[model samples]
Target: MRAAIPARIKLEITLSYLATGSSYRTLQRLFRVSRPAISKFVPEICDAIYETVKEYIKTYLMKPYSRVSLTKEQKVFNYRLYRARRIVENAFGILASRFRIFEKPMACLPETVDKIIKACCALHNWMRITSSNNYTPSGSLNEEDIDSGHIRQGSWRDEINKTLPSIGTVGSNHSSNLAREKKDRICRYFNGEGAVPWQE
Candidate 1:
């Protein structure tokens, strides 16, 4: 008699296969499931996940886009929102790179394809949150990187120090000239003096 595969094992295998964009045949070999079964369940589970998260997507992303002529506060809000949305783009890139399966066209039906994509994103988020703290890049920064970091930090400090007005001469002409000079110095530094040579 054949033993039944556990539900947890099935879920994990389906998710791993979808998340990595591995072929159903590939999943069959790894999980010892029939290719048909793997193909059917991956989409089913994906649909379930998509259903669960659909509300969140509509609430957060269905709003109107911001125009460039907005007020300062609105502009800041839009800028921050744009930056935050970049995390989603980065997540997709990371998933595609890490899972070679996603690098190719997924051969499943369109509905199945959509479900599989959603499921993989969910699995990716879960894995990222649960991963250990020791997952930094493989090696320490090289000398050039270290030097570049120091140079940027030093330039920032110098610019800030030069721009700040002296405490004793709040309204004097000398202080105003000093402040203007400080601003000019900072502008020059950023424009060329403090910039990395390769940045051009």
Candidate 2:
């Protein structure tokens, strides 16, 4: 029954919920759906979205041609795309427990489903923007990971040498720089100086 929902919406909601840590019951309440239906819709949506876009995100992996062509101007876009996926992937645990939006089997006009999904996604993105400031590392490993080691940025040498790499892709090296820059920017923007190595 719940299987009738389109896969795109399911994926968007899954990723958004994961990013925001909102729950099925809460989602049910917000969307007016039953918890059972919420449960039914989430995973299938996630799978559908992954199946749809998995190939488009090859730059996030170690694939060779995925990284070589990126110029500095496009660095930030690639960084955000790569990091968004990483964050979404990492946030799965948070999504499963924190967010399960099954809000009372939402009664929506068929035309407005897109609006709901976009609204949710926008809200999720805003939360992510704010999350870094309020976010606390839950584990010692995460704490250590912050200072693991600097990845010296110069070439696609390591990326290419990896079992599979993103060497030839556009903005690959630039994306690396963007990551470092994002770390610094986030830390500085949030006044997390000294606490985050990126700030120093």
Candidate 3:
């Protein structure tokens, strides 16, 4: 029987695939592993990586209200929320730019895709913490001019925009009473004590 592939080699193959979005055939040639073996082990490694790093993942779900609304306070609230959302989007853009896998949709099961996303996010966080200097060099992320409040597009935007299409939200239009109340309270805070001079 053929010798089993080393664990380290399998990890390197998985990371290479994630970072480049390479095809199985391409990876087989690059890693000298059979296509079938690469396909089988990639998902397994992703699941392992996600299991190891899932604790670092946190998500906040806040959907902005429609633009048709009036109220000055509501408009400000939306603006602030939009600004915060842009930061999250920029983070994704950075990841997509560096790890080309996200630039295109993965042809995997939903659960596998979920594992891949969590694994990539975990890797991104790890790199940011351990190698911030090289991982996120200057001009690689969106920046706002402190004086003018104008957003300066990051270098990642140019690459991500070329391939990543915008996707619309998929959910009901109606908000629950509790959700509405929470949103109102947050809005009040933003307009009141949490207000920043630059947010005007």
Best by TM-score: 3
Clashing pairs in 3: none
In candidate 1, which residue pairs get closer than 3 Å at backbone N, Cα or C atoms, i.e. clash? Answer: none
Query: Using lDDT as the measure, which candidate wins?
Result: 3
Superposed model 3: Cα runs more than 4 Å off = 169-178, 198-200
How much lDDT does each candidate structure score?
A: 0.54, 0.44, 0.84
**Candidates in order: C-alpha RMSD to true structure:** 18.1, 14.5, 2.2
Backbone-clash count (model 1): 0
Q: Which ten residues in a row have the lowest lDDT in candidate 2?
A: 135-144
- Candidate 3, residues 78-136, lDDT tens digits: the string is 98899889888788887888788887778877877877888899888778777877988
Better of 1 and 2 by TM-score: 1
- Candidate structures ordered by lDDT, highest first: 3, 1, 2
lDDT of 2: 0.44
Q: Quick one: how many clashes does candidate 3 have?
A: 0
Tens-digit per-residue lDDT, 6-120, candidate 2: 5565665566654454666776776665777766666555445445434433233321114577643345444444644555534432322233332223344444344444434
